[model samples]
Target: EDVHIRREVNALYVYAFCLPSCREYLSGSKGEGFLFPWSDLDIMVSKLPPEEISMESFHNDCAYIATTNGCKPGFCKLIQSYAKCDYYSRVEFLQLKQHAGFNVNFDQTIRGPCYSTNFPDGFDCCYALPVHPDSSNVFLRTFKTKFWNGVKLEIMNKNITVMHCVPKGPEKGDDDGHQWLISFSILEQNIVHSLNHVQF
Candidate 1:
């Protein structure tokens, strides 16, 4: 219990230093304040020029059309809708560039959407695009379900702004570079935070 408290305090301390405008988030076990000897940190970093979920047009170079073509359930391919810029040509390169600012020594392997690092401690840093729940039909349907009725109002009233979609390819798809996985890290964190000690 002492370790858990320490970890929570440390997380809060680190969060305090983040600029209000920054879109970085600490997630997984670390964000939930559960630390064991084997705990690994999970960090989600939101990308700039947020991509819109549009099927008709691409407003800018950063815009992409999220399609489920050639992907498994819960995965989608972010097909570039406009002419690609040199900097944001590929998802892999963009994610790598985003994670390069971290001080840790990362492993060569890319695990899903995150870059894994073993230096100092194990870390999985994922670069993602933020999407609002209001804009997503799936999210809207989910919130209306009976399971969410108990805490629906509380969740809606929370300060949560966005959920993330990580840049990762489907397991069996040839277009591995354009695949993205929808992530509910922020919502999961909120649920965990709302739990009582016994429920947790």
Candidate 2:
């Protein structure tokens, strides 16, 4: 249990110091503090280009609007109101630029929404964009479930802002390239941290 907690703390420290202010997160087994011999790192990067603005900000040609019109539950299609440029449209380009400084050779094959490395101690990196839950009624409805009954209001307020829209995984349809999965990584991390030793 001590080792588990230590691992989580170490990951947070590394990310807080080494990463930029783009809200990069350590996720998967390592972030949950259950590292096994085969465990690999999972990183989620939620940063927009310098020219872009968040959904709550001004809606310009660079803005991506999340719409659930034809997607499955917990997923939405990112529709750009106007295409002034292909910067955000080309997901691969954005991902490559984001990890350029890592100096690691990523595997040629794309794995779901991540760009993975082939080494034994490799990591899976994914790019995402932030979306405020209060910006859409769909998100508000999803959060008003019976599951949140006993949860503290403060925790909800703190974690909900961390919600993100990740690129759709390969398991979905071809049109998935334009789709985004709603992620609650921060909320999940908090819940894991709150678990008792036995529960963990």
TM-score of each: 0.69, 0.69
**Lowest-lDDT window of 10 residues in candidate 1?**
53-62
lDDT string for model 1 (1-200, tens) is 76467556855765686554346677776666666678898888775444544322344433566656556777666655565532222466555564665545635347767777786577887777765434443454456444443454555555244456677656675443655676677766656555655775
Model 1 spans > 4 angstroms off:
1-15, 19-22, 48-65, 79-91, 98-109, 145-151, 154-159
Taking the tens digit of each residue's C-alpha lDDT, what string does model 2 give over 1-200?
Answer: 66676666966675676545466677887766675889888888777333232343335433566666666777766655465432233365456654674565644345666777766568887777766444533344456534433343545455344567776633556342655667777666656666566765
- Measured on C-alpha atoms, candidate 2 has an lDDT of 0.60
Candidate lDDT values, in order = 0.59, 0.60
What TM-score does model 1 achieve against the real structure?
Answer: 0.69
